[model samples]
Structure formats: structure tokens, C-alpha cells
Target: MDPKEFGEFVTAWCPGCGNFAILKTLKAALAGLDIPPHKLLMVSGIGQAAKTPHYLRCNGFNGLHGRSLPPAQGAKLANGELTVVAVSGDGCSYGEGGNHFLAAMRRNVDITLLAHDNQIYGLTKGQASPTTMQGQVTKAQPLGAPSNPFNPVAVAIAMKVGFVARGFAGDTELLLDLMQQAISHKGFSLVDILQPCVSFNKVNTYAWYKERVYRLGEDHDPRDWSAAMAKAMEFGDRIPTGVLYREEKPDFAARFPYLAHGPLGKQPVDRDALREVMETFA
Candidate 1:
């Protein structure tokens, strides 16, 4: 997958949007992994971030709002050989799709979820999203968010996801590395990208993140769940980036004997094939 071959169209995102950086990082990651566009399937829920698949030259499913994971899981179940990646905005992933997010981790699905956590709903105008800081003011929450911002990394680490990490959209190099690692992992992998919504989010801007975000220490052990959770919890004063936790586990496909034949999608499908199965029932 050459980086040049990934994008088939120009992006529609606002100039200086963090999504631009993420898009570049993803292309580089896929290219580094040598996974061709035909072998990849990008599933996305409705949002500015969801448009990522449209820009890339790959099989893409523009799923309903907050519904990227279900199709991603179904696609993977049918064709476990496909490199499945789910992308969504903070509101789409953390707010409307929060339940699916949890279910994926619990099911240990073999897929990579790249969450664009920009702290605001960029696509729907300026609104406070699930990851928005409590004090942040938005059009929908003029007074303030009131509730604490959801902690995706902490939740993933506590649930024992196969791979959990965080990345900064500003740091393309580090994000590319994290995206590759997540895609390479066998089971559920979540990379919560700290994205800055230039137009919608005035707070938590690039400079704000730059001042707070730092790479995880080399001594930091990803296998240590306790240490990982602690790292995930660190924010405000300092934010840790990189793989927080990772451990191998039986992926959804491996747990099912029926999927041993490889992706069912690759098998022949026709009225004759369907009728043969119906005749067997008789």
C-alpha cells in the first residue's frame, strides 16, 4: 500500500483540521504494513471523521450514525482475513456509539478502532461531546458540559482490551506508529487520538495538547494493567501517549469454529449455492 495510492479524493475537512494529520498518519501506517487498499475495509459512523474512508481508496462502509462497529464486526466475521478498521468522531464513538465501543472490547473483536477525540462535535457544529471537559462551553452546553469527560483509555484498560493506546493528531510520526501497532494486534484495539477541532473547539487546541502530551517512558510496561490504567488516568497536567496496555487474547473469529474456513464472503455465492443449503435442510 503506497501512501500515494490510499487517497482517491481530496478531503472536505476544514483547513488546518486535525483530521488531515490523522488521515496522513493512517495512509503511512497502512503503507508501512504493506497492506494493499483492496485488502482493507474501513467502516465509519457519520461524522467529520467518518468521511475518512471516502477519501481513501479502499472498501468502505459509511454506516449509520454511531453504528460503525456492528458492520465492522459482521464484515470481520464473514471475512476475518480483511484488515478491518473503524473510524469515528468523539461524539459518534463516545456519545452515540459508546455501547458498541464497550461491546467490542468485551467481545474481543478483531478490529482496530481509531477514535478522533476532538472534545467537540465538529460535524454537527460546536457542541459539547462526551470527551469534552466539564467546564468547556459549547453551543449545546452554553453553561458548561457539567459532566466529567469520558475516559476511553481508562475504560479500555480496565476492560482488558487486547490493545489500548492514545495518540496526538499533531504528532504524525507517533500516531502512525500507534495506528500500525493497533492494526497489527489480534483482538480489539482502541487508539484514542487527541484531535483538535480547529473550527469548533477553541479550547484544547494544538498548543494546549503540545504542552500536556508526552510520550510514554520506555520503562513503562504495557503488560502491567495497573500501570497502564494509571497512565491512562494521567491528564490535565500531563497526558501520556503511546501503547498503554496490550496483551494477546483469543479474537472473535478464533473463538468460533464456524469461521475456521476463513472469510465466508470469499466463498461462492449464488442461487444454486443457496438452494443447495436449503435442500440439505429438507
Candidate 2:
């Protein structure tokens, strides 16, 4: 399908909304991959980030609050042929669904997770999110966020996720490249996009990000875990944006040799055997 097909689904976001750029970039990346629309599945949880699935014309699942990863993983396990992508906001992924995030990474499921790192909970009228910088004033944290923000890249690296990357919404081309790479990667891929909430978050605005964000170019080695960790730590003055780390580790499906033949959903089950199993439970 053409980009226009997906473009029609996007409505008016706030002026200079970073999500718009991200959506456009994602569409371009999908087009470049030349994958059939039917083969792609976009899943999301409750938040402004969840609205992305609705805005995209591709097959999508709008799931419960902070529960996008579970269903996405289920879908991948059931039908390995489909390309699964789970999208969520910082609060949805890093805050409320933190446990799920850790588990999914450990499992190393074949899926892509795109986090809209706006640093604040936009849908909830500007509450400080898990990634919201310390000392950043918000509606919930009037005196500024006291605790340190969750460093997603570092955490993912620590978890030994197969693929980990960071991008900025303003740079659509770069973001698209990262998305393409993440989707193609075999195991769990986390692409944290530094998005700006035009309406609610005034701290990490477009101008503010432009001043600090820098891309890790061709010379940067994504395979170097130590270097990637060092780069991930440098976020204040010079925020490095690109693939932080990548390793060709076995996915959860691969480790479980039984699933290697084909997807469980596509495999036929014997009615007689199933009946016998059910009778034992009964």
C-alpha cells in the first residue's frame, strides 16, 4: 500500500506535535521495506501513543492500559509470519508496565517496541512520567520530579535485549532507518523515540531537543555493548540518538525448539487428542 493510505488516518495533533513526524517516518519505513500491509500488525495500549494504531490504516489491536506487550507477544507466538509492533508512551511502558517491559526483554520475543518518550504523561494532562527528568515541574510534581528518570536504553542493555536504539521525532529519516532496522532484527527491539508533547510538556520541547540531540552515524559501532552503554549514559548536554546496541542472540522462539517448525496458530491440532486432554481435566 502507498503512504497516502496510511496518511489519511492521521488527524490533527497539536501544533508542532512530534507524533506527526514519527507517524510519517514509520509509514515511509514500512513502504521502503515493501512488506504487504496484511503481514504487519500494530498493537498499542491506552494513552496518546495507543492512538497511533487507530491512526494507521494497517491491521492493529488497541489493547488495555499498560498491557500492550503481552498481547503483542501472544500474537507473535501464535503467528510468527506477521510483523508485530507494540507502541506506547513513556508512562505506559516505563511506569505502569515496567514489569511487563522487563519480562518481554528477558523473553526476547520477536517484536518491535516504539516508545513515545515525551517524558510526561500527555493524555493525563501533564503528569510526570517515569522518564521525566528529575527537577522538572509538572502538574503532579509541582516541586519538580524528585526521582531519577528511568534510562530505557541503559535498562534494555542491562537486560541484554537483542536490539536497542534511540531516535528523535524531528529527524524523520533517521527515525525511519532505526524503525526499519528494529523491525528486521530477530529478537526484542526497543526503539525509544524522543518525542515532544507540544501541548503538555514544555521542558523537553522541540527547541530544547534540537539543542542537545546528536545522531550516532555510520562510524558508530552498535555491536560494542560497552561503548553503547557509555553513549547511553551521556544524555544531558549531548544526547546520542541512534542504535545504542545490537547482538545476534537467539529469540525466545528459537530457544524453544518446538516452535521452530511453524507458528502454533497455523499448526493443526487433533480433535481426538484434544478431547482426551479435556476429559482428563474434567
Candidate 3:
């Protein structure tokens, strides 16, 4: 898990992209966890974020646009032992993939989701994404974005997701720590990364984030849902970046007793049972 071993997935993104920092920090976190590369499965959908799997030296799935979550959940349900991570962009997750995001949170599947929140569509040449700030102009929104931006952390907190966190790409160490924590969490974990799209997004730049971002103090309690919601609402003056909330709730696997022992993918299907069912159908 050395930097050299995990640096292969570097060429897909644009130069000076914030995703590079995320990739680096993620690799560092994996190294710290001592998880074997082969045991890690990275899944992604169509977007710059989806390209992460290609860059990293691990098992990967490059899926359809806005469809990474379903398969990632399936992978986890099939084999809970493997470390499953899904990478997606704001446009992919909040736009076309919005329904799936809501469902995934509700089901409480055990998987780590690293969402690249750049506010603009980079791969499609600078369009307004769901997280794009109001009045922010892009190729798609020539007159500036009219609607309000989507707050992913707020959504996750409201949905009562097991682990909700936010990280800035600039702070590699802190991002790495957050990633590790998210991966270890039992249920659905969403890490909305405030990544600056160097080429397409100009408003939410590194300096803009640096001026506003502040870390939540050590005294804060991640288990407090109300407090976490309040913190999630903070945006203008001091943008809070850290683990917003975490509660050990019953996961999807726990509800379905059959999958409690392990994911279905690793288990051998009963051919006799299938034959009996087929015979009944016939």
C-alpha cells in the first residue's frame, strides 16, 4: 500500500485536479489500515470520479452513469469481507443517481461512498451540477445557476445515515483519517469531499474553501443527531468539515438474517433448491 504501488490510477483526471489529493489520501489510508490491495474493491459510475478505479491498483468496476451504488451494495452483500468503496461525482450521485442515493441511505448497506463534490460537471465540459451554487455560471447554465445547491451532508444527516462526514481535498491527512473511519463504519458511510475542479469550477476555489472551512472541535459529539444537523446547516461564515454524525443502527444485512453471516456472492447457491423451484414452475 505504499504510494508507489497505488499511484497507477493517476492519468485519467485533469492536471491540478482536487481528485488527485483524494486519491493520494485514500491510498495512504488503505496503507495505514494494512488492507491487502486484492481485498479492496472500488466501484464507480461514469464521470471523472468513476475513473478513480482505473488509476488505483485494485479490483474495480466502472459502471453506468449514476449506477455505482446498487452494484457496490450487491458486492458488499455478496462478500462482506472485501473493503467496498464507491466513488461518484455530484452530478452522477445527485442528478441522475438521486433516487438510488436515497434508497441506499435508507437500506443502510455497509459500504464507503466517496463523493467528489465539485459543483460543476468536469467531464462534460463544465455544466451546472446539483451541488452547483446559485448564481454560478457554467456552460450549461450560461446565465448562472438559478436553483439552490444540494447539501449532501445535510441530506445524509437527515436520512440518519450511520456515518456522515465531509472533507476538503486540500487537507490530505484529515481526509485520509475520515476515509479510514468511514470504511470501518458498519453501515452506509458517505464522505462528501469538497473538491475543487481546477479547470471547470472557478468560484469554489482552494482559496475560497480555505477562507471558509473550519474543523469541528474535539468536544463535539458525533452521536448527537440534533447537534449534527445543526452543524450540517452551518455554511456561510464557518463551513464545518469533519465527521458530522454516526450511530450504530441495524444494517440491511442484519435485517435479512440469511445474509448476516456473509455476503451472498461468496456463498454457494443451492442447485437442488433451484431445481425444486424450477420444477414447481414447470
Candidate 4:
């Protein structure tokens, strides 16, 4: 499959926005893996990054704010054959959808989460987001951001999520590799991409990230839990990017061995049994 198979169109995004690189990398990743538009499903919550689906030529769902995960998991449950990928921004995924993010990790759903961590609320015009650096001043917080920024990769690793990786939008090649690996993982995978909101976030610019971000070398073993934890906490001065951790475990559907027979949608429903159960509530 050619990467151009996912053609581009007019987007409601600012020039030099990191989202453009992410979108391009994602398309390349999907095509590189030979995943056709029909076999893929993109789910996203309301935010600037949520607009990713609009530019993709695949099955997609634009859902409520902070509510992409639930529907992504639902789609996977309904059709286990589909490749589910959920996309959202720092605010949508780590702020408003914080609880669901934790739940999804616990469930270990067979899906990939592309978190566009630009550190500010771009769509709402420059408010500090969940991943915003502490004490950073923004339009919404003129007094400086009081709360500490959320560390998604650290939290995911601590929770023992099956797959956890970090990518920088500035590095298209590495980001594409990370996206492909995350999507291919059998359990919940998270690629917390460090995206620069050029229009809203001035601190973490392209040059800023370029200086600090470096790929994990061949010496770093992704399966080493302790090593991965140390790598996850390395955020200042020198930041690491790449597959931080990987552990294959039973996914949500795998817990139910009977599901292997077929997806719930394909299975014949026992109307009589369902009716009897429904009548009990009467």
C-alpha cells in the first residue's frame, strides 16, 4: 500500500503545527503495515488533535470530549478484526479523559492511543494543559500554572501497561516507527507524542525539543521494567524517545476465551434467554 493512499485535504490547523507531522507519519505507518482503509478504525475526542480522523481515509468516529477511549474499546469488542487507534490531545486525553485513560490501561484493551502532548490547550487558545510544565504562564493562567504536569508515560509504565512508548512530532521517521509498533502490539499501547503547538505553546518549540530529544539506543531493553521506569522519568535536560516498555499480556477480549469464537456482533443472539432476563427487571 502506498502512503499516498491516505491523501491529504484542507485542514483547520495552523502552519508548522506538530499535528501535521503526526498525521503524515501515521498515514505512512498504516500504509507500511499494509493496513487498508477498510481494516482500520480511528476514534478521537474533541480537540485540535481529534481532527486527525477528518484527514484520514478510513473508518473514523469523532466523539465527545475526553470520551474517545470508551468508544474505541467498544468498537474493538464489537469487531475484534479491526485495527483500533484512538487519537486525542494532552487536554482531551490526560486532562478531561484522565479517568478513562487509567481505566483503559487497567483493561488492557487491544487498541493504540496516540496522545498529542503539546503542553497547552491550542484549540481553546493557549491555556495550560495537563502536560504543561509547572509554573508556565499561559493565557488562562496568567499567574503561572500552579499544578504539576501529568507524566503519562511514567504513569503507564507504573501501571504495567502492555506497551508504552514516546515519540516527538519533530522526528517523523522515529514517530512513524513508534506508531507502527504501538498499533501492532496485541494489548493497550500508548505513544505519548511530544507535539509542539506552534500557535499556542511557545515554550516547547521545534528547536527546544530537537535539543533534548534523543532515541533510545540498542542497549536499552524494552522488556526491562526497572530500566524503562528510569527512562520514563527522564524528562528534563535529556529526554528519551522510543519504545520505553513492552510486555505482552492478555487483552480485554482475551480474558473472555469464548470471544475467540467470533466478535459479539457476529454471534447469534439468544432472544429467548435475553427476553427472560429482561422480564426479571419488570
Candidate No. with top lDDT: 4
Q: 2 or 4, which is superior by lDDT?
A: 4
Model 4 TM-score? 0.98
Write down the worst ten-residue block by lDDT for model 4.
256-265
**In model 1, which runs have C-alpha deviations exceeding 4 angstroms?**
267-282
Model 3 misplacement above 4 A:
279-282
Task: Give me the overall lDDT of model 4.
Answer: 0.94
Give the TM-scores of the predictions, in the order they appear.
Answer: 0.94, 0.96, 0.96, 0.98
Clashes of each: 0, 0, 4, 0
Given candidate 1, what's the lDDT at residue 160? 96
Clashing pairs in 1: none
**Clash pairs (backbone) in predicted model 4:** none
- Using lDDT as the yardstick, the better of models 1 and 2 is 1
RMSD of 2: 1.3
Tens-digit lDDT track of model 4 for 87-122: 999999999999999999999989999999998998
Instruction: After the best TM-score superposition of candidate 4, give how far the Cα of residue 62 lies from its true spot, in angstroms.
Output: 0.7
Q: Comparing 1 and 4 by TM-score, which wins?
A: 4
Estimate the TM-score for candidate 1.
Answer: 0.94
Candidate 1 at 240: error in angstroms?
A: 0.4
